[model samples]
Target: MPRSPSLRLSVLPLLVSCLVASGALAREAGDTGLRLLHPFATPTPPGAPNGAAYIDITAGEEDVSLVGASSSVSEVVEIHDMSMEDGVMRMRRLERLDVAAGETLMMRPGGGEHLMLIGLEQSLQVGDRFPITLEFAERDSVTLEVQVREAGEEGQAAGQHGH
Candidate 1:
């Protein structure tokens, strides 16, 4: 039995639509699993050369590594970790920060880890917001709208948690 040309033409559109919709759904589900919680930066003094951003990154079902970050507000952004060596505090650039599956990595000031924004074009003030793109090794990159907070203010206390 030969199929009619009109019937085949109609079926093609239906098949294409189904495939497109399915792909969209899959991406949405996968991307939603990884989330940035309470992203914020502290206010910087006038003419300060550097500042830091803190956030809680919650990983999904699979492990992911934070490879890099970028922002227009600064000339360079780097992941850093603070530690004590011979009773002296030391900060160093980290190549990658790994977030294990079903785990959260907390980046906080005065803590162990944070994102260093170096060579600021302008001083960051309270109530200001900026866009930052976070790159990951095993998942899609996410752009976060980071809000500036008072110096030493914690994001958890300000209730800025988000998915």
Candidate 2:
């Protein structure tokens, strides 16, 4: 059946509006509304080794970034992200990782961005925690105790935040 042009035009506007609204909703979900994700169990090494830290940091009411990281464990600490180039996976250093306001940024091995620990005095095992200092442009310096887990993730992404 042939449809009228005016009828299609009217529906077009509604469809466009619906798509725009949907995008906004997705962004809102990604953003921190009134709460934030707090970092937990941030593990680092003493000397130097190829390792990483997996944690979930709560974002404040304002947007921020996980700019840089440091620890007594490693001589060098850097915020890094894992990406693939030409199907080859590579770990790249980042100036900062964005944290949406009132949202949580998951720094895991197999997802998103994470901290890469280079050169370790000793390798980390499960049931271990160490001190990790975080530096955010907006937030002041915060020292946190990070727990180490087995190869795979072991802790639930937990934190507390309110407006």
Candidate 3:
């Protein structure tokens, strides 16, 4: 069975919190077969990057891998994963993720899969937006401006790319 779109939309903020805290961000890209939902914020002790964007992706009708990511505000951007171990949660770097056609794959916080933006070059204030490029398996790509929100607010849902 498939999950409802609205239900998928609801968890975007919490995922955003996870991303921000972990150092990744996602802006509203309208919605794609694979979309980026929100930029969850992770807790930082001090002297951390300004902010990171979080996202949600719902693959519409094709299979793709979230191969690599790039952003101008940071030095390094890569796909990441946050998983559970014996009821313990942990985050790590992932090379890629497969998005099955018609499946609602979430790249939210606390999940086994996510994105990573390391070493910020700028400060992130509320209501800020930045640009990032996402590359897929078919050699196709798209660019989006990740919006920055408060530590708790969920980012706007991104739209699908192709039908």
Best by lDDT: 1
Residue-by-residue lDDT tens digits, candidate 2, 98-128: 8777676766556457777677657766665
The residue-level lDDT of candidate 3 at 154 comes to 47
lDDT, model 3, position 64 = 63
Count of residue pairs whose backbone atoms collide, per candidate: 0, 21, 39
In model 3, the runs with Cα more than 4 Å from the true position are 1-46, 49-51, 86-88, 155-163
For candidate 3, what's the RMSD? 11.6
TM-scores, in order shown?
0.76, 0.64, 0.63
Q: Which model, 2 or 3, shows the larger lDDT? A: 3
lDDT of 2: 0.58
Instruction: Write the number of the candidate with greater lDDT, choosing between 1 and 3.
Output: 1
